[model samples]
Target: MALMDGRDQQHRPVALVTGASRSAGIAASVVLTLAQAGWDVGFTYWTPYDERMPWGADPEAVTQLSSQAVGHGARTAAIEVDLSDPHGAAGIFETVERELGPVSALVLAHCESVNSGLLDTSIESFDRHFAVNTRASWLLIREYAQRFLGAHGTGRIVSLTSDATVGNLPYGASKGALDRITLAAARELAHLGVTANAIDPGPTDTGWMTAEIKDAVLRSTPLGRLGRPQDCANLVAFLCSPGGGWINGQLLHSDGGIS
Candidate 1:
C-alpha cells in the first residue's frame, strides 16, 4: 500500500466512508461520487453483516469499488472490520490515516438493520443495533473530531438516518439515537470548525425492498419512483464541499419529498 505523495495528498482531501460492503449500497455510491469530486477515499465494510442479510455479501465489492475509484483518479483504501467492537473506530482511523492521510470528511453509512417489531425484537438484536448504528457512530465522530487537522471550516461529518420505526423497531430507534449523536457534534465541535449533519434518504431500494414495498413507496412518493443511492451520494459530496459549509446541525431530508 503506497501513500500519496505530499503534493497529491495536499490537493485532494481524504473522505472516510463507512458501510461500503456491497457495490449496490449507498456508501459505494458516496465513494465514487467523492472520488469524482477530487477527494481521496477510504471506506469500511463488514462482510458478515451482509452475509446475514437476505442479500448475501459480495466478496469482490471492495476490490471492484476500489478499481472504479482509481479509474476516477482517486487514491483509495478499503478496510473490512466489524463496527460492533468498541475499539474499532480508533483502528479504522489509524489505518486510513496511515494509508491515505488525515481525513477531512467522515461519512457514516454503515448500519446493522434487521426488521423486528416492538413485540418480537429480542434483547440481543436491540443491543446489536445500538452497538453498530448508535454507539459506533458516536465513537467515529469523536475520533474524527479529535484527529481532524483539516483547514478551518473544512471538516465534514454526514450520517445517514431513517424514520421507519413501525415494523423495524430496533433499526429505527437506533437510527434516532444516531441522529441526535451526529447533530450534537455540529454544536459541540463548532470550535473545531466541523459541520455535522444527518440525512434521511427515505425508501431507498438498496436490494432490501420487495416488489410490493417498492410499489407502495412509489404510490406515496410524489415523484412516483424510488430513491437511488446516487441521490444521497450527491448530497453527501456537496456537504463535504466548501459550498455546503453553511448548512449544519440539521437533519436534512433528501428523500425526494417522500416524507
Candidate 2:
C-alpha cells in the first residue's frame, strides 16, 4: 500500500513502495516516479534479501532514494521491513501513516524470487517465496482496504506480476497467486471504493539479467528491447491516478508484448 486515503497530516498524499533496496530496480523507480507525480512517498527494503541476490544492494540505496524523492519536492519515508513476517502489514501501514499519512493507493511491488525450477526448489525456499510474494501481498491489500474503511475514502491497488519465468517455478506460481488475490480483492472491495490490478513487467533488467539472458529476451520481445523499470513505473503511476479509476480487475501486460 502506498499508504494513503486522500492526504496526510500536512495535507499531502503519501505513497509506500516495497522492495526498494536496489538503486537500479523497479521499487526505486516506483518511488521516484510517484514522487515526480507529486505524492509524498514512503518505501520499504529488506537488507537480508538484498544481500542474498546476485546483484547485492548498497545498504545506503534507500537513503539515497528517499533523498532523491525529496529533491522531487515530495516528502519521503524509508522503512526497513520484512514482508515475509506474518504480521508485517500492520506495522508497515502504521509506520507509513504515522510518518507520511493514510495510504490511498497500495502498490504491491515487493517479491522474493529464487531462481530454481521445480526440481531445484526446496520446501524452505518455496515457503519463503509464498510468504513474501503472495501472502504478504494479500495481507497488505487487506490492511490497506481496512484502513480506507476506517478513514471513509477510496483507494488504488496495483501489484507487479510476471509469468515468463521458465525455470523459477515457485516465483511464477506465487506471482500467479498474487494476480488472483488482486482480482478477487478488486471485486470484493469495489463497494468500499477500491480498484485493483496487476502488471506483467516481463523480462526487465532489474540488475539480475545477464548479457546472454538479455540478448535472448530482446529476441523474444516484439518491442526488441528489455523493459526498463520506468516502463512499469509509468503504468503504475497512471493506474493510481484519477484518470485510471475506471480500470479495475485486470492483469495488464507492460512488457512490450513478451507475454
Candidate 3:
C-alpha cells in the first residue's frame, strides 16, 4: 500500500528498487535520492529474509522509506514481495506499472548476504544466494527490456555488487555472477538506449560493521570513515542521469579508494 520513479513532464519517471528492507540501507537512500531528483519511486522488500539478519527485520522500514520519499514530493509504492520466486519479477513489474507508472530505472538492491565462508557454505545456502541475488536480477532485467522494447530510447539498470573473494563465499560469488550478467544485459539493451551497470559500494556501515571492522576498512579506504548509504545512492542517481548516458556496460568502483 505504498507507492512511484522517472517520467516526462506529462508523466513522471518511476524508479523501481528492490531489497528495501532496512531503513539504514542503500535502498532507502536510493528511494529518497531518486525522488529528490524528480522520479516517482516503487521499491520492493521481503521481511522473511531480513528477519534472520543480525539487525533483525523491520516490516515498517519499507513503509517509512515510502513515506519519506512521498514527503519529498514524489509518488511512491512499496511492494512487499519475495524476489526469490521465479515469477516475482513479472508480478513486481505488473504492480509497479499499475500503481506507480512505467519503470524507467531499475535498482536491483535486494540481496541475501549470510556470512558463510567456503568451508561453512552449504548447497542450500549457495542456491538461495543465486536464486535471490542472481536469478531474480536476471529475470527483472529481461522483463524490463521486454516491457519497453522498441518503444523507448532510454532506461537505466543498476545492480549492486561486492568484491568479497573468500570469507563471504556464496554472497560474493553470486554478486560476481550478477556483475558479469550485467555486461550481457547492457549489450542486449544497447540498441534500445538502455544502460546497464554495476556498483561495488565498498564497506558500508549497514549494521554489519563493528568498531574493529570499521577501523580495518578505514585503513584500506582513502576516506577516513565508513561509507554511508547515501554514497551509493548518489552514484546511482548520477548513473541514471542524462550526463551518465555515455557510460554503459561497465562496473564502476564507487568504493571510495578501497583497493
lDDT of each: 0.92, 0.84, 0.85
Q: Which ten residues in a row have the lowest lDDT in candidate 3?
A: 1-10
Best by TM-score: 1
Off by over 4 Å in 3: 4-10, 149-153
For model 3, how does the per-residue alpha-carbon lDDT over 1-259 read when each residue is reduced to its tens digit? 4643323434567788998889889989998999888788888888888788888888678767877777777887788898788998888889888987788899999898998898999999999999999999999999988886334446899998999977899999999999998888889888778989999998898888878898899998886878899999999999987788788998988888896
TM-score of each: 0.97, 0.93, 0.95
> Candidate 1, which segments miss by more than 4 Å at Cα?
1-10
Candidate 1 or 3, higher TM-score? Answer: 1
Candidate numbers sorted by TM-score from highest down: 1, 3, 2
Clashes counted in candidate 3 amount to: 18
**Clash count per candidate:** 0, 9, 18
Estimate, for each residue in 18-57, the C-alpha lDDT of model 2 and write its tens digit. Answer: 8888889898999889988878888888888978888886
Which tens-of-lDDT digit does each residue in 108-137 have in candidate 1? 999999999989999999999999999999
Which residue pairs collide, candidate 2?
1-106, 2-16, 3-102, 3-103, 4-102, 4-103, 4-104, 5-103, 5-104
- Give stretches of model 2 more than 4 Å off: 1-11, 149-153
